[model samples]
Every structure is written in C-alpha cells, then in structure tokens.
Target: MTDSQSNLIDRYQQYRTRRFLANESQTSSWLPGWRTQKRRRILVGALLAIFVAMLAVGVTCHFGVEWAPLLWLPVCLVFMPVWVALRVASGRQDDAPEAVLDEFEIDQRNGARSIGFAVMQSLGLIAAFYLIFGAVITNGDNGDMVYAGGIFTLMAVLIGGCTPAMILAWTRPDPDVDDLS
Candidate 1:
C-alpha cells in the first residue's frame, strides 16, 4: 500500500481501539471506588448513631447520674466506627472528586478512633468499678439493700453499653480503608 494509504489505515485502527476500550470500561461491573467508600461510610455512621443513642438513653434511664460514670460508652460506641469509616472514605484517591472528598476521611477516622478510645476507656472504668465495689457486693453483713442495688445497677449498665460497642468495634475495619491516601 502507498505511504499515505497505510497511515490512514493505522489512524483508523487507533480510533477503533480507543473507542472499544472506552465502551468496555463503561459496561464493566466495576464500582467507582470513591462512591463505594462514601456509601459505606454513610451506612456505618447510621448504624453507629442508632445503636449508641439507644444505649445512652437506656443507661440514662436505668441509673441516672449514677450511670453518668459510664457516659463514655455511648460516645465511644458511636464515635469510633463512624470516624474510621469517614477516614477511609475521605482519602485522596484517584476516584475521589475534589471538593466533595474533603476532610471526610480524616473526620471518619477521628470518629472511629474517638469511639474506640472511648470504649477502651469505658472498659477501664468498669474494671475499676468492679474492683472498688467487689468488697461491698461480697460483704455478708450488707443490711443496706439500697447500696447493694446501686452497685448491681452500675454493673448492669456497664455490661449493657459495652456489649454492643464491643460488637461494633469488632465489625469495624482496623485501619479504615477510607483513610488510605
């Protein structure tokens, strides 16, 4: 073939190849990574909020200010997972659109860390409580039933709040994929 004819054929082939690639990519069952991350964060946040709020309200009604010591349970249970999820979703990845993906990941990670830390702190408080009150609860001479009831109440509140938080922590990602920048 003549030089000009060969060049025209090559150009046509290149155009067809580009078009095919574009179409294939569009049809593929691949997720837009950023969008997927955002959706995940939303789901995690919603679950965390609902569960934490319920725990907090329940504990509040159960023990009033006596349960105040365990206030951190609600904070930790809700905050940590949400923070981690946000951090993972807010990374500076290729698929993340500018302006939209701002400090979202950072906030999410912070939330997760906050909640995780809170949960840990709450556990510490519970342990301390059990240690301090073990004597009173075990006393055979306890004629004051009210004091005993209060101690048992605290224990119950701690267990109620901590169990769900522990579950949430377990389900949450360790490093939070959203924060991968």
Candidate 2:
C-alpha cells in the first residue's frame, strides 16, 4: 500500500479509538440495569435467536413465501438496537483498543476474538460451499438458491461479527456494588 493509504488507515483507527472511548462513558448509563451477568446473558441468547430467525426468514422469503418479508421489518429493527445495547452492556470490551484495556481485559478480548475468528472461518467455508454447489446443482436455472445463499452469507457475517461481544457479555461478571458513606 502507498504511504497516503496507510496514513488514511491510521487516521481512521485513531478516530475509531477516540469514538469508542467517548462512547464507553455513555454506555454505562444507556442500560444501567442490563449490565448484570444474568441480563447480559439473556441479551446474548435473544440476539442469537434473532439471528437464526432472520436467516430463516430471509431464506424463506427467497423461496416465494410472501409473508416472510413482512417479518423482516420488526425483527431487523429490534435486532439492530438490541445488538448495540448488548455491545454497550459488555462495555465494548471486544472492540476497545489495547491501550484502553488492562492486561486481563486484553487477554479476555483476544481469546474472544480468536473464537469469533474461528466461527467466522467455519461459517464462511459453509457459505462458500453452499454458493458454489448451489449454482452447480441448479445449473444456474434457479435464482432463488442464489438469493438464499446470499442471505445465508449475510447471516454468517452478522453472527461472526457479534460473537466476540456476545461471548464477553455472557461471561463477564456483574460489577461490584459500592458502599455509600
């Protein structure tokens, strides 16, 4: 890459780091009650279920089920905000820059990232196989299978991207209560 391109990338990273740090303070207030381990785990479960539902709805819609498209609006709106809340509730540990995290936090984030990467790789392989074989099996006559494969690929990306935050939210302990003077 050229120097200008590298400089642009570095600038973007710095901007993102600043944004994440600014958002961290606001995150604690966004969902104060939901920061507990139990609630966070629940959020993680709901997110996973929603992802699966979205994938099913997407594939079903491609198969000519007219009603499936209607379900997308509510599910998608709910999915996006809840996913954001879950990330915030986890203190954005998975996305925080190393400089902003302690050694323990860094270790946890790296471990979760590793797991997320593995999941993405596995799901990515499945998506690739599905797309290639789908076209070959249909002799390119059926476009719906292609659409279905696209939906599957999108769902895989969403699931893979969210895995690390989900892991952090699910495993992190509740914060200790402070004593009042």
- Using lDDT as the measure, the top candidate is 2
Candidates' lDDT values, in order? 0.47, 0.83
Q: How far is candidate 2 from the true structure (C-alpha RMSD, Å)?
A: 3.1
Inter-residue clash pairs, candidate 2: none
Candidate 1, overall lDDT? 0.47
Clashes of 1: 20
**Residue 167's lDDT in candidate 2:** 92
Write down the TM-score for model 1. 0.25
TM-score of candidate 2 relative to the true fold: 0.85
Instruction: Please name the candidate that would achieve the greatest TM-score relative to the true structure.
Output: 2
What lDDT score is found at residue 175 in candidate 1?
Answer: 39
